[model samples]
Target: MRFSSRVNAGAMNPIAAQAAAAKAAGHPLGQLNDSNPTHHGLAPQFLPEAYTADPRGPLGARQAIADFINASRGRGVDSANAPAAPAVDPSNLYVLSSTSEAYAWLAMLLCNPGEAILMPKPGYPLIESICNLTATRAIPYQQFFDGSWALDLASIENALREGNGSVKAIAVINPNNPTGAYTKLGERQRLVELAKRYDAAIIADEVFYDFTLEPFDGNARWAGEQGVLTFSLDGFSKMLAAPHAKVGWIEVSGPAEDVAQAERHLDMISDDFLPMSNLIADCIPAMLQEAATQTERVAARVRGNMAELHRLLDADKQSGDGVVDVLRSEGGWNVLLRFPSSIDENALGLRLAHDFHMNCQPGYYFDMQSNGFLSISLLPEPTQFERNVQIILEAVHRELA
Candidate 1:
């Protein structure tokens, strides 16, 4: 029995698996961990009434993708700075089954065995798993936490520099999972510059673009005109509130030359996999057209729940008890909660599930070592969320005080 050195074999982490086990026990362990929209009861009818349409074929696929591109371009994006349409042609708009699979294509395109791709710490773990499974290295970059997470450019630059240019790409989750901070326009431009200077690509996973609570009217314009190769990853996942829809996309944009080369390669790869899901592709335009209203509804819910969570934490803080402090949440469904270093978030998390019967995510899973972090799904039903959050906050008060 033998295996390639790159074979991480997709082993499940015991902590998460145990949590899943507790959840599967068919009772209330106050689930605060997962961010699955369907699990939280997001209704599919909120999407445009056309989700049931099926893609006709290759031409049908092209038309479905074209509609999204045309609509996105017609959204009054500054055409001078942005492409205002999908680049490398509409056929270049390769549809995929999920963002996880998109990462696989991207990882193969960007990194070779043992080569590195920069990822955020206190970030999503899937990138690490993908890199490990594919034999590429997932290098950690610090997302500085001081009330809010900021992209540490100096550290990112150092990581690329220190790697002797082995870093092929850098991943940014616009509304990063676990931590909901969106990269600022200024930061986005800076990263593009760094990517070109380092000769690397910036893979922007923007699945949560529409769920923003505040206005980021012009952020998408940052995609091009930066002289860097940028791939914008997005799809029906969040747009339709239909995670079961199984549709995600990667749009290649940036420098004229790099865009061409990236397109040729991406198209070839897409051809090889033929990964497009006909059902999901047919549903894109309808989802886009109909999602605007639901977007507002979800954003409001996120803000209301997050505000309530913060109010409780603030009350604890005023009492000189450091229960938790939410970092500035700009956009996205989850917020980061920092607790005292002595609190073993994992152990406390298990205790909360077993003893207090509440659910939450430990900070360590996202790579926080010293500071204890807790993550809650912002998409939970309000009435139930308030009850669960009360229990979570009480548990935090007990653990940290």
Candidate 2:
């Protein structure tokens, strides 16, 4: 895959190369220029004795992530119907503070000024915000819904045609935030072909892949995709439901030459910022050990709440003051509640917040094309979620009345 000109194209310097060789030889050469207080016999109890600066992040942490991902991939798949997931390599992974940071790094790695990245409409605003911060254009491609959300391939194709090689990447959110729709197998194949044809990379955010609600058959992850260059992102925040964990990573895969070049540029970009902290890197192994249990715990919460929502909506349907539909959700913690179109989403959002003392995000917040849609999280405790649904139904009913 072609990278942006902003990336550092220079080769490794002599000093760093020598240091790498020395380290590989297992010779712990004392650094005359070592500036770390811990290495100099200060704060020995609080800090690591020495810093091992691997620009892709600490080797042990990356390996732990790789193992966890490889194991997790097969756990959810039915091997009888699908091919085995390709093995993940620690060298191909880059640990960062969050998926948001990974997005920024990718934006820099792929886009030059005035170049573009295609983003899904009715998607999270974070992608567009990152584009604006990096001076990259965010071209919107449609994700329309009939019974389920599907990508508008024509829209994406047109954007690539219009970009004329100026498009650097195509960003896809698996099981998209509010929509909760996973990219199907056929869709994935077409997307790979599109990226290959346009000479663009694919940036897939699969943080919500594990929380399957009502996914279609043959749904799968974008990581380890070999058809074209792809960067797959996931993090502890979503996997463990611990936002404070503040850990995320990107796994790069594609044609060998493209992967190598992308990694070289990414290493320089990561070294420039040195974003991952040694302290957090040290905790990754322990954190990963707890990931599967936490994932199951959180998955149960979301699935239960989704069922509660359906029960409440079904039981309350006879009231007839207004109708609210829970749009088909395949995966992810949130779902779109489509209310009566006569009520504007903005006004309803305000009413829920100001008068009802309920905080909610309106559909417009995600750039949904129409009104009267509210995005609701399925993460609350069961009784509280039931109560919240009742309140929402009452509010909509009152507005319609």
The segments of candidate 2 whose C-alpha lies over 4 angstroms from its true place after superposition are 12-43, 75-78
lDDT computed for candidate 2: 0.89
Give candidate 1's error at residue 313 in angstroms.
3.0
Cα TM-score per model: 0.77, 0.94
Worst 10 residues of 1 by lDDT: 48-57
User: For model 1, how does the per-residue alpha-carbon lDDT over 46-104 read when each residue is reduced to its tens digit?
Assistant: 44332212211244555666565556546334466644533335544556788888888
| Predicted model with the maximum TM-score | 2
Error of 1 at 388 (Å): 1.6
lDDT of 2 at 170: 91
Q: Which residue segments of model 1 deviate by more than 4 Å?
A: 1-59, 69-89, 213-226, 277-280, 315-322
The local distance difference test score of each candidate is: 0.70, 0.89
lDDT of 2 by residue, 1-401 (tens): 67888987776699878887888899856789988676666754676446666789989899999989878776334488666657899999999999999999999999999899999999999999999999898999999999999999999999999999999899999989989999988889999999999999999999999999988888888998889999999999999899999999999999999999999999989989984767889999999999999999999999999988888888777664438889999999999999988998777777778768998888999999988799988998888888888888878876776
